[model samples]
Target: MGADLYRDGVARLEAGDGREATRLLEAALREAPGDVKVMHALSRALDAAGERERSVQLLELVHAKAPSEPEPACELAMALLERTEDTRAAEVLAPVLAAQPDHPGANLCMAMALAKTDPERAKAHLKPASRSADADQRAQAAALERVLSGQSPG
Candidate 1:
């Protein structure tokens, strides 16, 4: 039952129905407490639903449960960055960055966290993301580069 709910919730989330996804994911979590995959999916649904604080909490839980993995840390850092908590985001990312310096998502997020306070540092972080084969990541990196370079991105 929990797995079914989780699958449907993920489908909804991928289809851009975050509110429905959240409801189903919450039910999944209740049926399978402490399930990291469900928790991560719920965090993503919550984030899409604009429940950033809840997303952060769930991401934190997942990260705590699996510190060796970088996904939760990256998600948590991005969530913190969305909340304008750059320092906290940086703190969350520090270890991940140290362990996987070239991880594209981590680099992109670190760039975002440092963009305002240290444009040069952000530029360094953005380099790898810009070179990534993922078009979205490259676009984001390019946009950030424009912003840092005092030019408008369009």
Candidate 2:
């Protein structure tokens, strides 16, 4: 039941029906309390619904519950970065980066977090991210690379 709701919620979110996604995801969370997958999906739905604070809070819980899991850590760090919480994003990303330096998403988030304070470190992370199978990650890495090199991100 919870899994079905979770899937439907994620599908709705992907379809850009944020409100419905949030509703379904919330119900899914209730049905499967403390389910990290449901929590993560709900966080995305909340963010899409403009409930940034709630989204970040849920992501924080997801990360805390599964710190060793790269996906949650990367997702939380990305959320923190969106809030301009670079320090906390970097802190949250530490273990994931340490564990999987080659993980595209982790490296990308780490690069963004360190871009302002440590361009060199950011560049190091970007190296791996630039080679990611995901085109978006590769493009973002390229853009950040341009920014770090004092060129406009065009």
Candidate 3:
């Protein structure tokens, strides 16, 4: 039952129906409070619903509960970046980078965080990000690579 709710919540989130997604995910969380995936989904739904602070808070909870889990760390960094808290985003990615230097999401988020202040380092990070399965990440990595190479982003 909880898994069904989680799946429906994710589908609703992907469809951009964040309110319904949030409702479904909250129900899923009630059924399995320790489920990190449900928490992550709820956090994403909150973010999509414009509850940025709430989203960050939930991600933080997941991070605190599972410090060794990379998904929560990556999601938290992405949420921070979305809030324009680049420094905080970078800080959040630090441990993830230390634990998994080649973590694609961490590298991608770090690349965006450092792009303005450290183009060379950002380019290096983008190497892994460009290879990510997420098309948006790939596009951003490719565009940043072009920018760092002194060519117009194509």
Candidate 4:
């Protein structure tokens, strides 16, 4: 029931209905409380609403609630990255990559974070991302793949 509402919120968010998505996601969160997926949606809605701090808070809650789940960790890393907190992003994504060596987003994110300060480490993290089975990986893998090929990532 609550999950359905959250799913609808996600659909709405993807459809560009940011306001409705936020409302629906909030309603779902009220019902499900600590549900990871709902929290994820709420974070996204808040971020899309330009409430970056609130989104970060929500995702931190998700991270606290599901320490072993890579999705929230990855999202948190992304949020931190947006803030240009590259070191923190690297810290958050490192363990995720260690746990799932082939995780597309984690690998790409970690690589992206490491790129500026340490190009070699960035290349190391990005190797698997280029070959990831996930389609989202392709877009992210662009710079990394180029970097690993001795070309400029940017």
Clash number for each model: 0, 0, 0, 0
Cα shift from native, residue 103, model 3 (Å): 2.5
What shift in Å separates residue 82 of candidate 3 from its native position after superposition?
3.7
- Which segments of model 2 are wrong by more than 4 Å? none
The residue-by-residue lDDT of candidate 3 on 111-130, one tens digit each, is: 98887788888889998898
**Worst 10 contiguous positions by lDDT, candidate 2:** 66-75
What's the TM for model 1? 0.82
lDDT of 2: 0.91
**What TM-score number comes out for model 4?**
0.84
- Give me the overall lDDT of model 4: 0.83
Residues 47-135, model 2: lDDT tens digits: 89999889889989988888756788888898788889999999999888777878998999999999999999999999999989999
Each prediction's TM-score against the native? 0.82, 0.92, 0.81, 0.84
Least accurate stretch of 10 residues (summed lDDT) in model 4? Answer: 139-148
Better of 1 and 4 by TM-score: 4
Evaluate residue 150 in candidate 3 and report its C-alpha lDDT on the 0 to 100 scale.
93
Q: Kindly list the per-residue Cα lDDT of model 1 for residues 1-154, writing each as its tens digit.
A: 9999999999999999999999999999999999999999999999899998888888999988875457888888887877899988887888888888898888898899999898999999999888888899999999999999999987
Q: If candidate 3 were superposed on the true structure by all CA atoms, what would the RMSD be?
A: 2.4
